[model samples]
Target: MIKTNYHTHTTRCKHAVGSDEAYVLAAIEAGLDEIGFSDHAPWPKHPLEEHFIRMHMDEYNDYVQSVLRLKRQYANKIKIRLGLEAEYFEDRMEVLKKFIDETPLDYVVFGNHFHQLEINGRYYGRYQKTNQLLEHYEHDSIAGLKTGYYKIFAHPDLFVRSINQWDEDVANMSRRIIQCAKEMGVVLEYNLGGIRNFSHVDLAYPYDPFWDLVAEIGADVVIGVDAHDPEDFLDFDSIARAEKILEQKGINVLERLAF
Candidate 1:
């Protein structure tokens, strides 16, 4: 059974809801052995307008302290890890590296929400277009994995949300990502957030076709709740669904990370 989740979030991210403690309590209630807080990492130098979905840079230290306090408090009850769901901004990697070097974090999961380069002086999100922007997504995501900074690649098939259909290009890109993860010794996440938010419709990610390629590549995989709310911490249905998919695909689903 999957006993750990490292893709949790808090209200500090602006888009997620619930306090740090609430998530822990919910995780315990749901019988999780470990829970990691991976709220969106702040880009301290990025323009204020760009901080829409993440916490402000000023709140970085406080977020760290909060999680650390909980880690100590619940040391015997459950394991807690400090982490960040980070983006790969090509020009700002040094800044991100600085944060990682200074912080006492267990891991960083790459969630390439934005493609590098600006259109109209602002970065574009992967969901904003179809196959046209897939190359950018593939390029930036691969770069982030190569950095060896991230332990898990979140939503490795997120491009499916925009592209909505599988073809030669999509299959090729999936193969490349799996191959890279295999080479880098990194694990890919089967995110449950997409299942929760887009359950009614066909999602671009958690795409079975993509995982079919993953099975062929024989890459390592893990399941993440990607919990934005405390309620999301107890989303067992989605977790079960993901497990079923992994089983069907013959993918190796790891219950926890080694490091």
Candidate 2:
């Protein structure tokens, strides 16, 4: 049985559709020790912005309340952690500090998916997604790691997400980020979503190529299925595949899943 899942989502996040209680019950059957409810933060609505959203702040608070209540109700059953899978928006370190300071958070997982990528003459977040370099991720992600606000830097190898390249610049930047996060005691996460969501031929975020530098640097690390729904909780096959990949790199860790 897996220990925990630190990357789970609930139906309240809008994009995901499953009851929070259902996920918790599944974790019990899966023999998970902990589960982090890290729903995404809400994106403001606009006529142009129709597809992106997370959970309302009020609803998020209610979620925390419910989880807390369940933790007491379950007591010896499971350990539920309150967290947010937040975006590393450009120029939002203070917002990070404020959010954590005000909220009762066990941890925060940072991802830089907000880059502006042009699509059909418009932008999809803005690298044209054409494999060009992005300053948002290169700079913002590094900054977030430096802020010392997270327990784990969710996906350390997001560099190849846009370019699918693993050359000099890629290696250099990755080394810097891993080194910085390692110094801060923030473990870098080697995610298995690439195995589950993106095929071996696809350009996956936290690309497998990145494990080379991560292992080379001897950075503290963890493996997560990046599980979203109940069906994915404590999925040992994905976890085993992730471990095998890391083992090929000669990097090993006893990580428990927690979302």
Candidate 3:
């Protein structure tokens, strides 16, 4: 079973529920060996703070300290690691690099939530049918992998959320992402959060075709709960479904993360 979840979020992210310790305690109850606190990275300088879904910049330090304290407190019960789930922007690479360098995080998972920084720009929150959006998603995702800053790539097939069908364009894009991940030596994550948020009928990610391509490419894969709520840490149904998909695809899902 996948015992380590590195994509956990906390109340600091605003959207998630429960305290940092609540997540840790729940992970322990769920029998998780390791849980990484990866709340949304703060972008204080960004102009979209009003529309941002992450924790405020002022709360960044408090988030880190809380995780660090839990790491020590739960040393005997479970392993805890501090991390961040961040979006990638080509022009803001230095800003991301500075945050990663300054913060004592164990890792950062690349979540390409937006294509670029445009005033009131459309992000993955809403679905659109434009091919340009698909291309931007592909380009930005590949660029994020090339940076080599993130150890794991979260929801590599998130572009499917906008795509209603798995056409040749979708397949080609999936191939590129899989190949890029293989070449960059990045671990691709099978996100279970999709199952919880979107119905199986409308779900765009954790898409089967994407993982089938991953199996063909022979890329390394990991399962992340993407836990935003405390109860999410113990979501067995989503985990089981994700595992079933991985099994059917013949993808190798790591039981534990090495780093």
Cα deviation in Å at residue 132, candidate 2? 5.6
- Candidates sorted on lDDT, descending: 1, 3, 2
Quantify all predictions' global Cα lDDT against the true fold.
Answer: 0.84, 0.67, 0.82
Kindly provide the TM-score of model 1 when superposed on the true structure, using C-alpha atoms: 0.94
Give lDDT tens digits, candidate 3, residues 74-175. Answer: 999999998998888777678678878998888999888876652335576453536576777888888899999888899887777777578898898889
User: Least lDDT summed over 10 consecutive residues: which range in candidate 3?
Assistant: 118-127
Which digits, one per residue and each the tens of the lDDT, describe model 1 over residues 44-131?
5544445777888899899999999999999999999999989888887887898789889889998877765322222432355554
Highest lDDT model number: 1
lDDT of 2 by residue, 1-259 (tens): 3476777777776667667788888788888877777777554333444434466645766877877777787768888887777766544456557768987888887655554221222221224545445444667667777777777777666556566456787778778888888788777777766567665655565576677888898887776656566777656687777777778888756556343
Query: Least lDDT summed over 10 consecutive residues: which range in candidate 2?
Result: 117-126
Every model's TM-score: 0.94, 0.85, 0.94
lDDT of 2 at 73: 74
Worst 10 residues of 1 by lDDT: 117-126
* lDDT value for model 2: 0.67
Q: How many clashes in candidate 2?
A: 16
